[model samples]
Target: MKSILITTTALVGFAATAGAQEVNVVSWGGAYEKSQVEAYNKPFTEETGITVNMIAADNPATPLKAQVEANNVTGDVFDIEVSDAIRMCDEGALVEIDPADLPAAPDGTAAADDFIDGALQDCAVANIFWGTVIAYDTTKFEGQAPSTAADFFDLETYPGKRGLPKNPKRTLYLALIADGASPDEIYDLLGSDEGVQRAFDKLDTIKSDVVWWEAGAQPPQLLADGEVTMATGYNGRFFDAMVGEGKPFEIIWDGQYMDMDMFVIPKDAPNPEAAMEYLKFATDTQRLADQAKYIAYGPARQSSASLVGMYQDGKTEMAPHMPTNPDHLETAVMDDPEFWADHDAELSERFNAWLASS
Candidate 1:
């Protein structure tokens, strides 16, 4: 009887081990996402003996919703743009995060505290931050660079072909700012008919010189190929082109628009606990810093700033992407994700119509 009982216990243990599940993660495709999986997820899998299945989705929302509605919300943890994160939370598609269940919150004095206040929130934590800065071909601009949106629109002073995102939020914001509206006044101004018309009118003046970029990667290519002398683009893409390819491109940090990308756990995720553990590990300072070296998106953890020096040699400087750089961060405006989340559909429709008609 004792031998039989021991055999039963051993069989049950083997069964439990065999039943251990894999967590599926959905994230954008980029160097940062690849580094995150390598540094954090792979280690977590090794330590816990749980498998990780990563899926790349250019826009996380479509796949996320399809999985949830199909009752297969197996993509346990995913990263999405801040605007999409907010929209998902509103749609009841994301799970509420319980901080206590996560790895002990980083000690308050640790690098985590350096995250910009209000950047971290209940539904999501900022994973990486990037900016849409003015990227200009150094060969063309030389010493003179466009400093602000007004400069971008000023064809008389800085005449050249320019590229801009086809997305309505950026286009509208830049329009208002170029038309002499403050960043704070953008949403309010767009709320009225006159303000919207004013923005459209301002855009009309520069329409002939503008080339629309449909993808994030296109702007960097446009500048490198000399298709456009100046373009609006994310800092990381421009940094990679300049540093990796030795392209003569430079980013103007003045009046850049800062946007946060966040990590979230989907509702009905099969392995919420494991996913939370992965998030905690991914946000650790050392790993985040290593990621920053390869990918120009700034780390959300404050401690990662100290690690910047490790990447900088006499020949190379990583300062262009560091979030804590006072001169860069001071003038950078945090995009209002909530407004974009609410108005994107209508705004996108109208913007597309205008683009097509123009």
Candidate 2:
């Protein structure tokens, strides 16, 4: 009887402590973070009375992996790309996320059936379907604006510095697109050595005029600063600059690289219960749709699509800007997490060697 009383009291005390602790969510900074804060964080705190701390990183997975390996995990939740989520989960670094634990759609659908294909994973729940699209300074092109992927490589016609992500996964597909590889053939082509060489040769054409950006925020800044006239960047960041800040930029939807951003909790997170609560609350249909108002990222839930409407400014319609729109999907390159999972390391190594040679 004495031991049972002590054990119950200790459990109660631990529960109270966990309730008081904040959930530190690490994610990509800039306008993307701002959108999550506005749509998910603020309301979550209001209802749960738990203070949610948001930390920004160029890629949240970097710090997440470092913290886990060092056994000093600071973040309770991390928003990462699907490829990283899969890689980390396979390494036993993330907590398994069971779909049964998630809230179902408002219309009485199960979460397993409600989420879009590939949005839910073994250890992560995807929140957004985002795109890596090209954005150009409208002022720079006074005539015959760049409308297609092929135009990105037509330096003779466009005649300006191109801003590309330093990473190979993002750049290689665009190179293939500009070189006339069909969207359906991207992954199969990338799997071959000859295809990789073809991509490298295509990249070599504009190697002199390329300005490489590592962070999601840099592409918009590079274009805004006049450092690069045409740049590839997140569609939402470009949306924020064009609509929110009124920057003179226009997005080229052709051959956009569509990818999803997922939310995962580390196995050894500082506050596991609260972290789970935040994950559940923030990924429901309503919250997913709410995110669309702040950024152009498409909601991962099919039910959320009907709920998405005007942008946060209250005047601008958001349908046309979403990368998941049928019109936009026609030429877009959908993400294949398995391909990147198998080839990310080798391609990255070759990409670095090629970069050095240039």
Candidate 3:
């Protein structure tokens, strides 16, 4: 009887070990992914005994679309732009998520109420509000530094290659901003033929001096290499390069393009249960706020705002560096995911044609 009992206990232990899971998450690489690993993945595994596998992509949505089309869904969760989330959800490639299923705030506020507007969706939940803003090398300008959007395009004074992303989503908005358009009317203007042409016309001014960047990590590297003096890049990446690595860089918050990154599970994910569990764990108020310690992006949860504090260095405060800060938002262009979902392909074509033209 003693031997039989021991055998049974050993079998149960083996079964428990076999039940352990590893969730695969696709995300943008660099310091942003590091934040998730520290604040979400590590603690989640310690508490739940589930491992997390992070996969990097230029944009997670690209791999997600390929996996869905190929019918071999490997990644469990994808960290994608809100526009990509909206577009993918519309195509029925993503699973529907209920806000009620998410954990409520510590104060008993509902998740739906706690999250900022546009943070929750039927198929996605936002994690951070980041920005595409201007970053210039402080040592580049001796007397007067570039302070605004117009300064980015003034080649005569700045006199260095400008790093602009190779996408219309990021470039077009800046062109409009530099051309003296109001941030509130960016989307509306882009919707018209004249406005689209005007944006391209502004681009024509500095096309000869533009050094195009395709990845989030490239802008900083371009600036560091002296390939570009002023560049448009993710605020978090620039923050990491500046504060974390002690790069001689400074961010010009003028005309930032703000957008949220949402976490979504595909319908046929390899580990649906684990994916959902990780998603719920990672987007809670505390986790969202904790991420602020590593990156300057704002937490998506309203309750998380008060919880945010000093940076990971334990010295620098994270608030003023955040893209959502009031001073930074004065000229910020808020991303319209719905508008991008509808117009991305069309505008991308035009942008490509202009880039290819003389």
Candidate 3 runs further than 4 Å off: 1-18
Candidates' lDDT values, in order? 0.72, 0.91, 0.91
lDDT of 2 at 121: 98
lDDT of 2 at 301: 96
lDDT by residue (tens digit), candidate 1, 1-358: 3433443354345335645767777876665566677666766566556677888776676788788789888688887788877887878878765443332223335322456564566677776778878888877765666777788888877778989998877777777777778767777877777887788888889888999986567888898778898898778778777876789887777667888877788877888766765676666555566676666777776666677643323356677556446778755667888778777888788788888875
Q: By TM-score, is 1 or 2 better?
A: 2
Better of 1 and 2 by lDDT: 2
Question: Candidate 1: global Cα-lDDT?
Answer: 0.72
Which lDDT tens digits does candidate 2 get at residues 1-358?
Answer: 3433443354355446666667899999899998999999987776666788999999998999899999999999999999999999999999999998887788768789999999999999999999999999999987789998889999999989999999999999999999999999999989999999999999999999999999999999999999988999999999999999999999999999999999999998988888987898789888899999999999999999999999989999999999999999988999999899999999999999999994
Name the 10 consecutive residues with the lowest summed lDDT in model 3. Answer: 2-11
lDDT of 3 by residue, 80-100 (tens): 999999989999999999998
TM-score of each prediction:
0.83, 0.95, 0.95
